[model samples]
Target: MSQDTQPAYRRILLKLSGEALLGEHHYGVDPAVLSQVAEEVCELSRRGVEVGIVIGGGNIFRGAGLAEGGVDRVTGDHMGMLATVINALALQDAIERAGRFCRVMSAIRINQVCEDYIRRRAVRHLEKGRVVVFAAGTGNPFFTTDSAASLRAIEINADLMIKATKVDGVYDADPFTQTDARRFDRLTYDDALERRLGVMDTTALVMCRDNELPIRVMNMFAKGDLQRLVMGESVGTLVEGSRQ
Candidate 1:
């Protein structure tokens, strides 16, 4: 393949907020959004980039919000985990429909619905050119899906981790509210933490920093952004160690 068409990374872990699947709706998964995301993923797979995904459950449930409303924190988190599984299944269907082999692997077991997450098996699936979607937030309470994305990316030995968001990249201020907000092209992990950039949770940022894993934050809704990013087109805010 020519340099322009070749993918930059061999394998990647994509972290998507559940709200990304909300589209124009106030709640629930939006079919249009799911289809669009699946098409993007399948396109990457077709280009020989191994893809793994970790999607959040905020659209269906928010554990932290419920805990503040008098529900038990642990119970709420478990419920939130289940919500992720629901999204994984939905996304898996969309990916398959887009003509790619997909798997839904959960941290928590649901034998009849999906495979229990196994590090070796998940890696093997990626090597075989299949997309794996990881659901459930570390199978533990109080851990965000961001943390799970970092953990899984490390475990799978991914070349990069991509955090998909509505915004094009990290900004000095809320881009939607601040018309003049400056979007950062690059940032160090320490810079992100020190400035409280909210690129990901502190734990997730620290994990990537300590492990030397790079993260690319980009707008998922933008046409061809994901494709351009994976093809080494530099379409997002890249966060890594101070070295680069």
Candidate 2:
């Protein structure tokens, strides 16, 4: 492959918010959006990138949101974890239909539906060129999938962690509401944390910083964005332990 086509990283962990699955809908997964994400992932796999994914469950249920409504926090969080399993299964089917092998591994076991999450097995799946979708949010309450993504990325020894969002990159202010917001092309971990950029949850960001794992935030819905990013093109805001 030519320089432009060569992948920048051999392995990556992709974090996708559940809200991203709600394309043009009030709630629930949208088939079109799911297929689009699957196709993007398949493209990466074909290019020799070992892909691992951690998807959130905010679309179907949010533990934090329910806690404000008098729901027990632990119960709400467990429900949220199950919601992630639903998303994982949906994505797995889409990826298979897109012509790539996919596995859904849940932190909270549902034996008949998916494999239980085992770190070694997950890594082995990636080594064998299968896309592994990690679900169920660390199998615990009070922890967001963002934390799960960081944990899984570190466990898998991923070269990079990419957080796919609706916005193009991290900004000083909400880009949608503020036209004057400045989008950062790159940032240091300290800069992100100090400024409270909200790139990821504090736990997630700190974990990546301590481990020196680089993070890239970009828009999931942007055509060619994921491809460009993995291919070494500058397509999003990259956060690292220090300025590179």
| Each model's lDDT | 0.96, 0.96
Stretches of candidate 1 off by over 4 Å are: 1-4
How does model 1 fare in lDDT? 0.96
Each prediction's TM-score against the native?
Answer: 0.98, 0.98
Give candidate 2 misplaced runs (Cα > 4 Å).
1-4
| Tens-digit lDDT track of model 2 for 153-181 | 99999999999999999999999999999
* Total clashing pairs in model 1: 0
TM-score of model 1 vs. true structure: 0.98
Residue-by-residue lDDT tens digits, candidate 1, 45-158: 999999999999999998998999999999999999999999999999999999999999999989899999999999999999999999987999999999999999999999
